[model samples]
Target chain A: MSTDDVDAWVESARRGDRTAFTKLFRAHRSLITAVVFRMLGPTGDLEDVVQEVFIQIHKSLPDFRGQAKFTTWAHRVAVNVVLMHRRRARSRPVLVEEEAGGHEPDAGLLPDQDLSRQRRVRAFYRLLDKLSDKKRAVFVLHELEGMAPADIATEVDCPVLTVRTRLFYARRELAQMMHDEPALAGLLAELELAAEGQEQAADADEPARTALGQGRDRRSDP
Target chain B: MTERESHDNIELRPSSEFSARAVRHVVAEVVAAPPPELDWARLETRLLERLESERVTLRSTPPGSLGALFGFVAMAASVVLFVLGAGGPAATRAAATDQLVDVATLPVIDDALGAHSHLAASLAPGSALESGGAARRFVLPGVAAFMLAPGSRVVVRRTGEPYVLELAFGQVTAEVVPRHDTDAIVEAFIVESGGTRVAVHGTVFSVARSPERVEVEVTEGVVAVGPAGYRGDTTGHLLAAPSRATFAARDARLIEVYAPTRATMAAAATPRRDPASLLPAANPLGISRLAEPDAEREVHVRAASRQAPSAPGRDVRAEAVPQPLQGNPGTDATSPPAAGGEPSAAGAVAMSVADARAAMVSCLRRATANAPAASLSVSVSSQITVTLDGDDDVATVQFAPPLRPEIQGQCAGLLFGRAVAGAGSSFVIPFSSR
Candidate 1:
């Protein structure tokens, strides 16, 4: 659907049109679920929180003045729901619940690959829980959600400089935590090796690309 | 994919340093999980049903005559109670300040708690059901969790207000949910023992109380211990996490504290001292047990003292006495170091555990400021056991659950090799963000 169609559907949904509301829900469901999943980390309450987000969106739909994009509004709604969910429960959930597996889509993930990925993800979240809420939100939006600092500042309602500063400190804190966590030793070693391998690959490819750019011959003088 | 917002693959990028390379990988894995494939039709149905039900409830419960009458009657009763009771703000504050406490830490919670009439029976564990209290754990769900010792008894009272649990005798470790300043139940949960009441917010702490004295040790968060009814958020000495304070149970006077740099921090900014930091008062690392005759007392504290005398007139210098650890137990608790061939602590300066802790805190604060990429804004918990060798007064720091071998070197660099006090005594300091 084009922008016009979305805007029309939003208008109808604002006016309580069931079909229009359903269409909008289906349209934004993926974005909403992805955000809620990442923000809440692999806890199993993604469904309820998503439902709460839609409900909240429906309730506050009239107040949304189209100042931001529909997805941005939906993202903010999801963030707010996650915040409320944590505040109400005050429970620090770990990935033990996900250890049984089968929750993530297994389309292409190999068995060993899946387990290591899960372990790394779990460790990251456990450390992530230590961050204060404000810093955590800003970090997630920028680092995980792939948002630019300026965009994050707009989303989190903070100054751009503030967002950049938070991101800088958040990265540093996370790096130190990764080093300090004893359980992640083996994983940390693997990551460093992988980094070294990637750097070597890039180094090998760089000369060939440079030679091509300069129209140089392949054979050396020797 | 949208205008102005680019969902770039920033998370998959490598960090700037080798030590932190794991952060990029873990974060990448976390966000890599595909958006779940849910039965969209079913999910939408459930969501619509919930919304409809809420709407119906709101429509059905439109305030009517009966609701108005109930509200009026409750308001009138509240007004009468307010006027009839002490017609002062002090009384009102007292009512609002009523605290909620976990009885699991109370020793006399069994049958001898009657003399203390304020001990609300409602919170007495297994009281009404008369269920045998055979060492059961009482959980306050999300708020707090307590482990009952072998012979101890406890009852959970889940109320919305704050409380005071008078600790006649007992030892208990509790991890409480972090509370905010804006909570509806704004009053702090108080644990009252002999002569002091320890008020705490969100923190993990352990309290041990005897008829004669009480000791409160905080492993996380800040706590305030003052006389039984000291109302000073400002005046009460603050004890930051990983420190312990001993008070006379009857007199409730603060005898000694093993807190790090609290006095210096508070002295520097007495008015502006973050109530969140340890209190401004000097923490003279003192454990009443240090004076006991027990040969197995293991007192672990963060090392590094500024050499500032913790307390006036209490210049308890480090005697050449060997307070050897349990493995190498010294004969007399106070006997001179010449009692045996064990390495005498003669040359070791008397250093308190707080000295090293202060040094670490100061060093870390600088480390964060100096290293742009090494700053710490979040709380990180790492416990280090430093043994005062007295040989060179150079303490050996051991990090439990150990850091990466290379990074361990970095942690030591943060300490700057400052001399640790409390010669011959092992001190375990749990470090965190100030």
Candidate 2:
């Protein structure tokens, strides 16, 4: 949506227009839920946090200056809320349940393929949990969201070099963790073959070939 | 082989699909998870309910009649007369020079003063005042007027010196009347928060004490702010109007001064009804007491003022009275229709770039109407790449050149899991704030 559209709704909401505010909430709810979910994982109180975020947004809407996009400002609020949640959780002790045993492979897939992928994914999150907040945020933005270091830097309010350094460390740690797990090792082998197959497929398509070349060029840069 | 050797032997290409799969899993488990179904109607009802409650709280009347006002004024007059009549000439002189500030307006909260419910009493040195639920306004006649935010605790330090307000917690906004003469009676007013001290003579500012830092925002005049002990020393920074500074709780010496954003100035300028006007007219003896229950009196006064003939000078006051939000409360179906024709079950008709840009701009403008015009002046150009799911809902939103840190979170939050009106597809559109 255009900035003007967002601004008008903000104005309407500020004026106590419930419909406008609801529109704003509906428009941004998914994004906030996703970010919060990614940052804090699928906790039971996810909806509560989302509600708090919207309430805060409503309270603070009057002060929003449009210095940045509405979404950007809301994102900052979500991040701060996540950090605060972490802080509060740290102050008090809570019981954490151990992970349930691995799921059995469905009828279609090979037992190793299904179990290994699930295990690798679980192990990935575990490794991510070990990283510091800044590093994890940088890594998630860059690797998961397909954002560049500079973009991650902008989002996290850090220098590009810092983002790159954090991503590097996050990747190194995750790689080490994966190397230690035999299932993850097998998953890696499968992913490498899949990527190679896709690369060959892309070579046959002219646009994809160009995009792949451009991607290579970007990665090759300092 | 050593652990380092094994690590070196392993191929760890950062961009390999293994990393991709891990990221995909994380996304699937978190970002792509089905959000809990929100009962929008119920949520809206609850929100409106909360808003109504706040409005009522903010507009309620104090529990007393005009008789209470008269009785309070009579009692205060009797006390003054007793003091003057009983005091000898020398004692009367000392009493006249006493620098006690009066409570201009009692907060609406039930527990404003803890055990002491009455704010009709003057605030003396060494006296501490605490407020809950509602903000209390105190006036040092001709010196300053300060409103303490809810849940704030402030202490009036010893007299015969620069008036010192020790803030233990919460926020306070002070409007210090300028002293024209160099030898004014009140030499200075200082707000002490944590280890940071803000010294002022004539200024409108706010000081908020948070867990990690003390934030000072100056709106009108200059102030000297620094470590609490550096009273006359040059250890602190001089902050001018339209600026803010934060002092860390752990380190007094470290102060971060930031240029005031549009939001800062707007917050500092939030209109407050004059507490004196909310009270009944001053008594014949010129003593004004807190009589009105809540802000309802202010609203009545506003309604009365609106009925008066529109004198040329009254325009400013009319502008000052905040307008209630426009729109009927019951209407819920106000979402604007999509510009293009309705989407078929198979797929939405692709929106032309120009049409899409116009639609987006209109939406954004509506969303940010209340934002400061100056901050909105800069044209923001963005390229939004939207990936749609099979149902035509938005699965992802990516901005080119990346969004600013402040905007990214909101964009991600609102765009990631939304369903747009179209079949599964990926498209990029450029939008500009003009």
Candidate 3:
């Protein structure tokens, strides 16, 4: 959900409106899951992370200053929660990603057909997976999400220089991986062009996408 | 990337050859849509549990709002007024001078003396009575003779041959003489501001009473502490033997306790028949027992002031149906219906046993009185007689077999434990498997 919408719902939820809080959760559930799942991974228990994020928001909501957007703060909280879970599980790691099971979706692995647009998109994500957790996070936030390098560094609690270095390394690694694999590289190029075209289309549909993003931002705030 | 490009599937476009190549390779290896729809029921339950626990902790030590502090201060002031009393102007003036640092207002009282304004101190033959501030010491000639503190009262119904103190009060302690046969017994009590009273029999126990709560410690004997109520309530619940306690105003509970000594148990066991089996129906709250012959012995037990029916002589006898033993051998005797109709059958059995044991112990004394040199061990058996209240019909009678004195001692401990655990009076008697 957007900051304004979240701020509105938060004010109502604090007043004891249960429906407002549920509406908030339902609208933002997908965004929360995406953020949590990124840091936690498919096998990572994101429920705990999501719950912690909301609970922390609820507990600390009374202290919110409205200086920053609720979505920004929520993203920060989601990252912290997933990091904490990772730290706790590091000793006895139990990664249960769908890749290890028959339940794996068709979108996961590379297809052997003459590459389709969707297939190329899937291939690009496959390349992104090769980067380390920290580097991948920086790439997604900086290059993909276009978040400011300074803000990404602050969110990850790292030096801005480190965020830039990680992003640089991630991009270099992706370029090299694509170049080394000829067949995959051709598909990757097509996918990148298609993505650029979609961006144009999405900008044309900005008002609609903005509405969906705003709705999501609101629910995930608190 | 521009905002337009970033918001769209920028990496998935076919026009950007370099970005497309990278995106394809990334996508080829990227796992399926991440499993984001996690089962949250377990997390929700855990959060609820934590919420409940947090609430309880918060409630136990709630932050006092303005009115709450006022209530606390008011309650505290009232207690101080009641304890100091209107008559003690000098005490009140002195209290004002030391209001902040007065030992009386200390958050927690250390021992029996700190908790009570009135205290009973019984010194054995050689023990010295220490005079403290504001305390009026009562010196009894021997262990048998007892003293009552100011604002405290006790009734001594009878004195055993060896001399034992029968104590009932807000606070009292007796020094035990190893050579003597009796220990101090304190009964139904009310500590000025404290809600509970602890009664100890056949031991050296000290009690401290405060307005909101009472604390008791048995330095060397057995004690029973219960809640002696206020206004119209009298069924004071006992606060059982707590090794040490920091009681608050709402502390009224029944606790039964026994000091199990191998030597004492051996001595008690040597005696034939269970002393508890001989408990007297007349004194249901009896704590001490002695050998008595087939003669009259003075026994003291508490009944509601209303339960003591009027009679021409000390010996008042009334009859009712004796409760069936069921599986218990002597339970019927313990639970005989009172002479005047009252639902005290449950408590009566233990009281009756205490009385009968004391009576039987007196019988042994009588048996030895004729032959001073003979120290023959004696066991007493009692029978419960149930009488038809209205008519002169001969009701059924049940014989309660005797038990060894030591077994009675164990029963005393077991009973006290159960009573304390159940927070009730009357020995919550426990039985052995055998």
Give per-residue CA lDDT, model 3, range B317-428, as digits (tens): 2332222322232233233221112222123222233343333244333332342245753333332221111112111111122122222222222222111111121121
Point out where model 1 deviates above 4 Å: A1-5, A89-102, A154-157, A180-184, A194-222, B1-16, B39-42, B61-434
Worst 10 residues of 2 chain A by lDDT: A88-97
lDDT (10s digit) by residue, model 2, range A1-222: 677888999999999897888889878887877676666653554655676677668878889988999998898787766654553332111124333212222435577754554565556666777676777777666554445566567777889768767766777677666766665666667778888999888777978878989999999999
Q: Report the C-alpha lDDT of model 1 over A166-190, residue by residue, as the tens digit.
A: 7667777777677656656667787
Error at A181, model 1, angstroms:
4.2
Candidate 3 Cα misplacement greater than 4 A, ranges:
A1-8, A12-20, A87-91, A95-133, A143-145, A177-222, B1-20, B24-434
For candidate 3, give the lDDT. Answer: 0.36
TM-score of each: 0.40, 0.35, 0.31
lDDT-based ranking = 1, 2, 3
Query: Which residues of candidate 2, in runs, are more than 4 Å off?
Result: A1-6, A66-69, A87-91, A97-123, A145-147, A179-186, A189-222, B1-434
Q: What shift in Å separates residue A48 of candidate 3 from its native position after superposition? A: 2.5
**Ranking of all predicted structures according to DockQ, beginning with the best and ending with the worst:** 1, 2, 3
Better of 1 and 2 by DockQ: 1
Model 3, residue B294: displacement in angstroms? Answer: 70
Q: lDDT by residue for model 3 over A96-170, one digit each (tens)?
A: 222311132354445654234344444445565666668877876665445677778887889977977786677
- TM-score of the second chain, each candidate in turn, equals 0.35, 0.34, 0.25
